[model samples]
Every structure is written in structure tokens, then in C-alpha cells.
Target: MNPYFCVMPFFGAELSSNSNKITPCCLLKNNSNIDEIRQKMLDHQQPVECSVCWNLEQKNIKSDRQYKNEAFDFYLNKDIKSIEEDCKKGLYSEQIIKIYTSNLCNSTCVTCDSYSSSAWSSLKGIKEKKSIISISALAQLDYSNIKMLSFVGGEPLYEKINFDILNYLIKAGNTNCFISIVTNGSVKLNPDQLNILKKFQNLNICLSIDGIGKRFEYIRYPLKWDLLLKNIELFKSLNINLSVSYTISNLNLLYYSETIDWFNKQNLPYNHNIVKYPLHFSINSLPKEFKSLLSIEAKHLLRKHLPQDDAQFVFFVKELGLQDNLKNISIKDYMPEMYDLIQKNI
Candidate 1:
């Protein structure tokens, strides 16, 4: 049976930087055998290359599949017959088009590498891979039915292409689309870009921040604490909807509660997606003692800030234990709480 007819499971696509090939999802690599994956998708069979979400499901983790599924179910005309016809017509009733084309960014974040950030290019000694969506290519794609256009980048604000696209869409009178961008919150949008942004029906900003003052600077690196705050206030003044993306990593594991409290005071909604890549950075890499202290702190914050899901407090320690056991370094030497918590928990 056609999955598109029902709640279509695999209707969305993500385009990566430097290579135009459509990927299974953002976390996975591009499908080398596009025709085969396309054929499997059309046949309502899950593509073999789409193991990222499949594995996530097996592990009982919420994957990118759920987010896209919700978008497709709500936006598309879900009458099974109409969707089936669209599928047979060889077109995706696409709900989201997540694009990442530029590696240009100001801060060379410790967790990121040259593949995603140009700032790390020289220091990383990796060959640059230049695969951006050109103007000629953008003009050829069909944006007629798409509902959401997500722009994620090395840093979206660092590239002129993002602003140009927004202006282009505004000029084209495409006001039905909901545009969202994930920025580092270090560079504020220019006056022209802000003015053009107001033309869209809706635009949302996800500020990528990891920690509180000193912790934040250490993790994101070279980004001044004051400047990041100034930029966040700048975005606030523009009167745009804002959300915080706190990537929970080992670098800031001890300060999650403080970071959440700071954003909570601003009445900003924040999400914590565990950092998986660069395994050493994952909170699971933290010493067991550090995780114990972090867990107690996170539990209280969850209760105080989000009483509805207080049970989620244990996620901190649970994730630490679940970490891939990469002990390349130890936090015990650095954190005083480690020595104290070790005695108590032990």
C-alpha cells in the first residue's frame, strides 16, 4: 500500500551542502543509489539507506521522522486518493525542504568540524567542499506546494544567499510559506533582511546556544558572552518569534540548569537535543561523578521550570550512562563536584 495515501512516513527530504543529491534525512549521508531509494519510496517500502530513523525507532528515541510526519499530515490534503494520485504523478507532496548550503561561519565551534564550518577550514587542514545551491538551480525548483522552507547553516546570517532567497520569495509574492532559520545568535540580521523578513506569513528563529556565560563561550568558542546576548536582544527587538536550541554536550553538562533558567526568565522556549556527533563531546563522555551532580541539578530545574514533565529529569544521568564509553579525557580533575559527588553516589 502507498504510505503517502495514509500518514506518509517518508515524504520530506533534506539537501546537504556542496552536493545536490537529496539525503534520507539530515543526520544520514546522501544516498549514492538515488534511483533505488526513489523506487523503494515509491513502492511504499522503507529505503535501506534510511537506517538513521529506523535505528532511532528501535532505540525508542524520537527521530526526525516524527517531526516531518506531523508537518506532512497537517499541511497536505491527506485525502488518501489525492495523495496517491500525486505519488503516481511522480511528485512529492513535500512538507519541508531543509537546506544547508553554506559552511561560512564566524565561530569555529569546538563540536563542529571543517565539513560544516568554514572557520575550521584552515585549522582543520581539510579540503574545502564547495557545493552550494546556485541561483540558476534555485530558479528551476518547484516551490509551488511546499509549506515550510528550513534554512540551517554553518551560520545562515553569514551567507548573503539566505537573505537573497528571502527577498526573492517576498518579491515573488510567496506569502503562504512558513520560513524558519537556525542561527548562532551572534550575528544579527541586517536592516534590509529584517524588513524583507516581515513580508513572510511567518518566520521563526532558533538561536543555537549551548551554555550560560563562561560555559557558553568555552563550548561555542571565541564568541563573546556579551555579544551573543546583544544579538539575541537585537532579534527580540525585531518582534520575531524566538526559540533557543541548547545542544546538550559534555562541554556544558554541569551548567544545563543555569542555561535553562536564564532563557526561562526571558520567557523563551528552549529544546535540548543531545549532541551525538564527535562522541567525546557527548554528555555520556562525562565522568560518572559529574553526571550524578548534573542529574540532581537538572532534576530540580525540570521540576521548577517544567513541572509537567518532571519525570524527564532522569534523562541526564541515563544519557550519561548510555554514552559510547569514550574515556579520552576525565572531568574529575576539573570539577570539584566530581570528587564530592563521587563520595556521595558511591
Candidate 2:
């Protein structure tokens, strides 16, 4: 058995308008490199395409590769030669599917871009359109045999296509398949939507929460903290598996200790990943002096995910100033401590 084997390259796929190539996962770049990735795994060699997982593993953090392999273990337990043959002969079907239907989100999060959120496009006056998935493209997939279906979006809860895909699975009598949705915990699910979701045997709702209270509202932008709390209670009432996905960036890393304590008090299942793109938002951009005051855990995280350049701090400050002006909001009002820290450093 290949100890480094991953099932995603051959048995999983991600559908999004962000790329034209067949992408096996959202963390991986959109490209037709699956064959290469698969062969590399077969040879017990790590492919650069799977660096996200390797990086996380190096930091002793659980990666998507580990989680996916475990989740799809039932399907991958067959003979290795048989699995290879099946894939080559087109007998193996896609059992894990991740779909990002459109960029039709309500809130414009600081870390997000116009490509992922319609609200960001509107705020920036970019005139971008929602990139909805085509019916023909969705029709190509065999949903009946699927073991897992994941949806993320402009906010999966707001995307009409997300529910449409759920309805498709329900109608196909594939309600037993695992369903995962990453939402912003902003939208309230309607009775009809709630009923549809209740029919699934395994449903995991992972909220994208970067910070808590006013800080959350500040980073997520225009999304009220009260609304998020109300929605969290609403999802809790559903008796489904709920979890939180926390992203640590320059905006929220300073508040990591408190936010994590809050998650612990709420007894919420949670996982965190550091922001690496838009290098300015990375924790590494923070001055050493500011970072010196961070919690031991936060400092450890910073070390794990080092910054490409500390100079990017200037860009983050500039961008925040521009956004504060446009939104008619002040970071000093929402995040006084962080504002004070930045002020002293710069």
C-alpha cells in the first residue's frame, strides 16, 4: 500500500468557474495535472500540486488530504491494482464532488475578492457577473454513486444552485451521501430549505468565522454579529453536524486567543488555516514588535506559515484605509486593540 496515497486525484473533483481545467480540489490550482499527480502518488513522491496538504502536515496540522482519505476510505479499500484498472477503464466514478456554483454572496469579506463574492464586485464597482454552473456540466456527473458532496461559494447558502444540487441528490434517493457546505453563517435558512437539508443522512455545515463580535463584523463587513449568532442558534436547532472554519490573517490573528476561547465556550467543532494569498493579509506581514505580543500559539502558527515578505504590511494598511473610507466604518471603532497595535508599530 502506498502510505502517501490520496484518493482525490482519481476519485474526487471540484467544479467551479474559477478554472477551466479539471481540478480535484479547491486548494489545488485549477489545471489538468491530475494524471501527473496520480502517477507521483503512485511512485510515493509528493507532487507540488499537493503542497497545501504537505505544508499543513509539516506543521502537524490536519490537512484536507488526511481528512478526505479517511472519509472516502470505504471506497478506496479495494485492491490497488483493481482501483487503478477501474480508473483507467472509466469504471471508477467520482465519489467526492465539490461545487462552487456562483459568486452570489451577500457579504464582502476582507479576505475575499470580486471573483468569489458578488458583493465585493458591487462594492468595488467592478461590474462583474455571477458565474453560475451550467446544467450540461452538472449533468455529466453520476450523482447516485457519490459518497460525498461539498459546496462552497459566494456563500453556499445563498447560491440557488447549491440547493438545486441538493434537490437532485434527494430526488435520486441518494440522501445517504455525505453533504458538506461552507457558509458565512449570515443567511437564515427558509423553512423549505431547512426541510430539504433535514432529509440528508449526513450533513455538515461549516461556518466561515474569522473573528468574534465586532471584530467579526468588521472583517466580514456589513455582516452583523447578532445575525451570525441568531443563525448559529438556528443551525444548532437542526441537530446536524456543525463546525467552524477559522481563517487567521493579519486582521484576526491578534484576536486569535479570545476568538478561539469563544469557540471553545460555545463547544463548536473548529479548524483553522492561515491566509497565504494576498500576502498582505498574512500574519507574517505584522511587524516583529507587534507579533512579539501574540500568544504562544499564535507565534507558533506564524512560524509555521512564514511570510514571503514583511514589507507587505504597508499594502494591508493602505488597503484597510481605502476600505474604511468606502464603508464609512473605522477599524479603530471595531478593533480598538489591533488599531492601537498597528498605530504604535507604524
Candidate 3:
């Protein structure tokens, strides 16, 4: 057996050890030769499955098979030793570590699955629970394997605790570690805070903005569009790498092109993703024209940045059409009850 194969369950291989049978998915053919599988796995250059894999798994059995295969290939070619070496160096590891700082957010966005009054109520008593990990614990972590440190939350910038943690990491002299923050861009980082972040050469900010002007403000309620724009400008002026992430939903589906055009005008890298409504909601109820617009935009974007990504974009467009008569109107004109459902989960 190849050394990489020693790590069983490569990507999507469902092995029923009791029966000694292997069910090959997209990553592996039903009767694929060992050499072919190994080569394909090597191409992925990583060990773990990403968000794409998770999204695919939630779809049909066919997608699960494809996801498994992709995962298997990723692990097969990952350089375990190199990752170990980087971690041991204690400077910067190639692996990405997402630290959930806190669940508190200032925004009451309708589509946010993490921000409800009840959710805030649940957190009230948990103050004594110590959700904030100690700085010493972070310093003692095995960084040799980590390539990036992502601070995610309901909103990381809302709390000082999250900033403190980030400050500690930067001071630790792990300059090689890439730091990423996923934020709503509502909170402004003061000059001192900005200076600390600037010390880390690899710091990147991903701002979540669903639409433009009133459309964005309506979906992400309690947030001012101008405030977000100001913060974005500040980040850009500081030479910080900034990206915009738009979560496509029924509320802003019609403004897909407008959203893209707006982000492009800002000269920021932007990505649009569909809202994965939880299991309770009917996927068939979503708007078809909205999905179609996203598919078209995705295809156009991929042509310039990721030629290979076009296939997946096409897949989603087709998936939307497969469902029964979902309304075909642009969502910008009307709000759906599904927005409330999303808020509850947030």
C-alpha cells in the first residue's frame, strides 16, 4: 500500500471494513487501478475537504460521491511532513485554523442564521462559561501545521476579547501565519487596532455584504451601508487585502448583477454564495431566476479567475431547474418568511 493510502478513507471511499469492501465515489472509479487513484489524489495537494465538499455532501447522493472522490484526491497528495515541519517552526504553518471567538454580533440581518434575540438571551448566562480561549493556550498551540488563522464569529470585531486574541497571535512573531477575519464590516477598527493588524503581512479581511445601498441595508438590518463603505475604504487605503462576500438569498436575488457591478466598482475581490437554507425550509421554494442570475454571474467570474469553477456553477444552475416550479421572480422586490427562519438559526 502507498504511504498516503495508509490513511484509509481517502476522500470518498466508504469502506465497510466488516465486509472488506470499498465503495468508490467521484474521487475513485468503481474499478480504478491503485496507480490511477494515487495520481488523481496527488493532484488535490491538501489533506482535508473544504466548504465545497460540505456543500456538495448536503445535496444528492451523486454529489456525495463526487465530494468523496475530491476529498480522497486532496489527502492523497498532501505533504504531511512539510506541514509537520512548518508547525514545529512555530512561526507560520500552512494549515488554516478558524477560531470561533464569540457568537455575539451587532447586526440583526434578516438572513443571518446566527443573530436572534433568543440567541443573545442564551449567551447572557454563558458569560461565566468562558467562551474566550486564553492567550497562553493560543501561544502553546501547535502552529507548525497551521498556514492561516481565521477569526470567525457572529462578529469577531464586536468584542474586545477577539481583538486581544488576534493581538497576542501577532506579537508571537508568527509573521508567516496568514490571518483572516470574516466580518460584517459594521464595526470600525480604530487606528491602534489597524496598526496591530498591519504588523502581520498576511492579514486579509473578508467583509460580508449582501447587496447595494438600501438593498444591502435592508437584508443586513441595523447596519449602515455608508459605515461599511467607510471601513472598506480605510482598509483599502491601508493596503490591506480586502474581499467582499455576498450571500445570495430571496431578498436580493434580483440585484445579482447590480451587486457584482458594485463590488467591481469598489475594486475589491468579491464572491457570491447562495444561502443554504436549513433542512426545515423547502429548497423548491427558492426563486429560479435568482439562481439563474447567480449561475450566469458565477460563470462570468470564473472565466476570468477560475476557468475550472465554471463546471460547478453550471451544476448549481441545473440543480435549481431540477426542482419543481419555484417562483422565477427577482427577490429584490419582496421579502420571504424564509428570512425569519434564517434569523432564528443565526
Candidate 4:
């Protein structure tokens, strides 16, 4: 057996390296083949037991007093000190801190649950308000275990508050922590602002772009698509890891492939999210034709990208099944008010 195959045991999937059939470790009576074991390892790189099988095994073991005692002894004798140390180094190094610098935004996007016009209008009325975090407050934070600090808002670059906080973090020699910002990429960052971001090698930025050309304008509303592209190019030139976050909705459901192709050409990592039950409207707020298209695209993507043994993908598909029910129900059936809201806003 190849020495690399020895790593397989750590994954808890018992199968011969030659045959590639996997037997579920949770199964007390059955043996696994090598292929089944490989698939299980690919499902989750992390060590995890099959929840259903584990529960079943636990029940069976409890029925047998001798087996139950053996299981208890095995667990008690397991030396997990090395595993605990590795986890501490990788994940527990820091607590994540999120700073909401300001609620002000330049663009009024249609899908913005965070900052609708009504919400901003109310915030604007607060007298003597401090929109930005003070430099002193940021310096006071205990950075003992802060793995990352995220700056999020109506749009981090819409105002000077974000820059203030970012500058403080950089100057404080807190290079150990990763710094990230979620931006619309509309505001053209100055050279000084760009330099500040570049100082932190672990800094990352997420740009939200839903579609290409006019479709983006329609959904994002008031956001300049060209300016966003220009800013993304600027970030690329700086050698920053720029991620495009695309929120999949009925408006761009049919255009998923087109958008993915575009991102691929741009050499940018992209992620997609299905429209969830929003605070304002139900599935009825989405157009029927678009909703149906979204369902089809979502199913196709999941089946194509997800492996059979992936538990997370299985759960994801189950959730998509519920959303697919909108095919029989029109958006107007549940969200008539959304039409009026969109019309009034537009």
C-alpha cells in the first residue's frame, strides 16, 4: 500500500487503497470499498462522522452493554492533544470583529435589505450622530485572538469613516489579523486609500456584482457598472484577492452561465446565493418566468458541481426543492405590495 494511503485512516473511511471502495466507519457490521472511501474523504476534508450512521450505531451499541463499554473506553483513551493544538493554531487564533462604520450609501440598490431609503431617512434624522468609529476605540480592542476584522456598511467607501478605522488597524502593527471590507466598488478609491489597503498583505475585498451590463444596472439600481469594473481592475493591478459576490435573484436567474463565464474570463473567484425569504417580500415578489428560470439554473449548477457523497450539497438541494415550489405560484399571488413598492421607487 502507498504511504500516502496511510492518511486515509485519519479520515475515518476504511477501504483498501487498491479497490477504492469506501465502507462507512459508522457501520459496525459492514466493510467499505476503496471508491466509497475516496468519495467520503472528498466530501469533507475535515474529520467528521456520518450523522445518520453514527446515530444508528450509537443506538445499536447502547443495546449491547459490552459494546457500549468498549466504545466509552475507546473515546476516553483517544489522545486528541495534537488535534486540539492544530485546531487552536488554525481557528482559535482570533475572534472576528465586525465594524459597521456608517449606514450611509451612494447607491439605492433594489435588493438592499440593509439600507433601504426608508432606513437611511430615519438614520439621517439622528442629531449629533457619529457615523465613523474613532481611531482610539479601534486601538483599544484586544487583538489577542482576532483572526480577522471586517468593515461593512451601506458601502464602506461611501464615507471617510472606514478609511479612519482601516488606517488605525494598519498603523497599530496588527498585521497578524486579516482585514476585509465589503464594498460596492462604486466609489473610486484614492491612491492614499489604496496604499493603506496594500499595507496589510492579508486584506481582502468583496465586490457585489449581480449581472453584466444593463441587467446589473436594473437590479443594483443607481450603481455604475463601468465604474465597478474599473475599480476591480485597479484592485487586480494591486495584486489583491478580489472576490465577486453575486446575489442570485429572479432578475438574473437565466443569466447564471453568462455571469459565470464573465467572471471566469476576468479570472476572479465568484460565489452565488439564491434569494431567500426577505424581510419585505415573499417569493411572490419575484417574476414567475424569472423564478422558474432560477429554479432550473440552480438545480443544474448543484448537480454539475456537487459530489454525491457531499452532505452539505444534499442539504442545499433539499432547500432548493422548497424554493422550486414557486413555479406553481406567481409572484403577484403573495407579494402584490412589492409591485407597488418597486413602481413607486423606480
Among these predicted structures, which one has the highest TM-score? 2
lDDT values for all models: 0.62, 0.82, 0.51, 0.50
Between prediction 2 and prediction 3, the one with superior lDDT is: 2
Q: Please, what are the lDDT tens digits per residue for candidate 4 over residues 95-173?
A: 3455655566765454553333323344334343324444455555555434456666667777676677666665666
**Whose lDDT is greatest here?**
2
| Each prediction's TM-score versus the true structure | 0.70, 0.92, 0.57, 0.55
Any runs in candidate 4 off by more than 4 Å, and if so which? 1-94, 113-140, 279-296, 300-346
Which of the predicted structures, 3 or 4, would earn the higher lDDT when compared with the native?
A: 3
The candidates, ranked best first by TM-score, are 2, 1, 3, 4
Query: Total clashes, candidate 2?
Result: 0
How many times do residue backbones clash in model 3? 20
lDDT of 4 at 20: 30
Q: Per-residue lDDT of 1-346 in model 3, one digit per residue for the tens?
A: 1222212222123222123243333233345564354344344432233333434344421232342233323433445444323323432212434565555677655544333222333423333332444455455455443445666666777767767766666666676566778888999778778777778777779899887777766666557889998988888788888876667654455456777788888787765455545311212223333234344544332213233233433443343232212223322333333333323323
Q: How big is the positional error of residue 271 in model 3, measured in Å on the Cα after superposition?
A: 2.3
Q: Which stretches of candidate 2 lie over 4 Å from their true place?
A: 30-32, 74-91, 304-308
Tens-place lDDT digits, model 2, residues 1-346: 5655777888887887565334777677756477788778877888898887888888887887878777676444665555655655656567899887788999988888898899999998998878887777789878788888888888889887788899999888999899999988899778989999999978988889889989999999999999989988887787888888998998888899998999999998777777988889877888777888998878877764344444788888888998898788999999999999888977
TM-score of candidate 2 to 2 decimals: 0.92
Lowest-sum lDDT 10-residue window in model 4: 1-10
Residue-wise C-alpha lDDT for candidate 1, range 1-346, written one tens digit per residue:
4532222333555666666656535654543565566567667787666665665555554555555554454556465456555766776644567778588877766578677787767555567864476565566445665577788888887788888777666666776677778888887567787777777756778888887665566556557779878877877777778887778765566667777789899888766566655555544554443454565655332212332122232443343333212222233433344334534542
